[model samples]
Target: MRKVFITGTDTGVGKTLISSLLVKKFNAYYFKPIQTGSKEERDVNIVKNLTGLNGEYFLPEVYLLKEPLSPHLAAKRENKKIELKKIFCPQKEPLVVEGAGGVFVPLNENSFMLDLMQKFSLPVLVVARSTLGTINHTLLTLEALRQKKIDILGVILNGPLNLENKNAIEYYGKVKVLAEIPKLKTINSMGIEELLTNFNI
Candidate 1:
């Protein structure tokens, strides 16, 4: 795929970790359009350290809100407005863009993260936590994407390996289980590179 838009079922659902993995495997340009919480550890920082790729590999975020909240609220907190026209996708191939949260996450008063994905027109690579309650979360995420008529490339299960959850997601969602990512005690090139075997890239 030329582009892979990484999104999660919820916050802390391994979007950045998976994004960094895809960046390493594909040697793709990593971009997180809007980022919240600039004072603490940002996703870009984590991705940079994990992927071990610097220089042109990372792209600057469009919106950098100071609060660690939803884009809409985060922008609101700063008395700023998130204009869709401001978020532009770089004309780079093999790009891997990560969303802040689930597909339905609010970006502005009327727009959501899904709206941004629609604008990018890239196949979604759903990153879900591999644990209890993932079935419902994955299915609901798939359903939302379906309703939006967005193409879902596949699902990536992160955390412990759970066969039952994986089977349920594939059978019920009718989407391919692209890969299952186990929790890594340490994020390094060697370990991260090994997990890439489960993916086609």
Candidate 2:
């Protein structure tokens, strides 16, 4: 088993859902270092509820900003700042960690999500949309990770299966199409288990 950092081509790209899948697949702990958004929509809670996992399987977020904005602006709104030094992984192995938005999302004035990804140095699994515009977004994300010399586990396509987009991403991005998760009528542990059988990490 290997620890993985989950990032997305953009916000609302189903990172949390994929994170829950990985956590369930590996029986691993889930950690979201910095979370921005209202308390009601916390990623940890969502993962726990979706997977029916307990608190032991989830780690507390370092920064839980109330505003649903970019991390830097959200922290500023609350009169605080995000520091990379304060974020660290628990001793648990094969943990699944997720990022806020895209790779370039700002964490602070000087540091972006890319900086934190580098700090962790975990192999990355990028979650991407399985629709139009994904080619550009997914390719750019892969390229950025490559330039940083980050080890990419590959990309996961979420939504209705689009063969063209999947082939384009695999060919142009030069990365494996690890899995294609369809839009489930009900997103729960059962759904995740079904998807697990469809693809291997």
Candidate 3:
């Protein structure tokens, strides 16, 4: 059972893509505890499409906010409070959990995504971009995770391979570079399956 929480440096940094890859790699259930988006824009649907997996591999989100904003704000708009106590990992093992944004994003007025990561207490694998300005974003993310005493598996650089960025992240952050995924011409199950070969997670 290889369970990991996949977070990113920020939103749209390929967290869902990495989650899909890991779900396929380990044949694990994909769980995104809090999703803040419209009904049609769910990441779980995208993951299910990419992995071409059945419903059993997916778990229902605890909070599915209709607004596409941060968890706290989205929940507020709906007049709902995001409670930590209501969240529980499924009985299924080898799960791949994904956070709703960057680690610092607030889940409520007081708690942050970092707190959710702590609640899950699973090892994290950060999905970062392989481009300019990534060094700073990645280092800060790593520091925050360390501050919470979270176990980090390493980083997965999503995008074109940039040796400079990769070396800097590994050297300065003192974290391993698990994989470097280049841009894909076509994103589907076949592409995801092929890309899984290059991953070391």
The lDDT leader among the candidates is 2
Q: Write the per-residue lDDT of candidate 3 for residues 76-189, one digit (tens) a residue.
A: 999999998899867777899999889999988789999989988989999999988899999999999999999999999999989999999999999999899898898899
Task: Estimate, for each residue in 1-201, the C-alpha lDDT of model 2 and write its tens digit.
Answer: 569999999999999999998888888899999999965589998899877877898999999999999999999999999999999977787799999999999999899999999999999999999999999999999999999999999999999999999999999999999899889899877788888887675
The residue pairs that clash in candidate 1, if any, are none
The Cα local distance difference test for each model comes to 0.89, 0.92, 0.91
As for candidate 2, its clashing pairs are none
Compared with the true structure, what per-residue lDDT tens digits does model 1 show for residues 44-123?
A: 88888878887598999999888988889999999999888888888897899999989888988789999998888889
Candidate 3 similarity to native, TM-score:
0.96
Clashes of 1: 0
lDDT of 3 at 68: 92
What TM-score does model 1 achieve against the real structure?
0.95
Off by over 4 Å in 3: 198-201
Provide the lowest-lDDT 10-residue window in model 3: 192-201
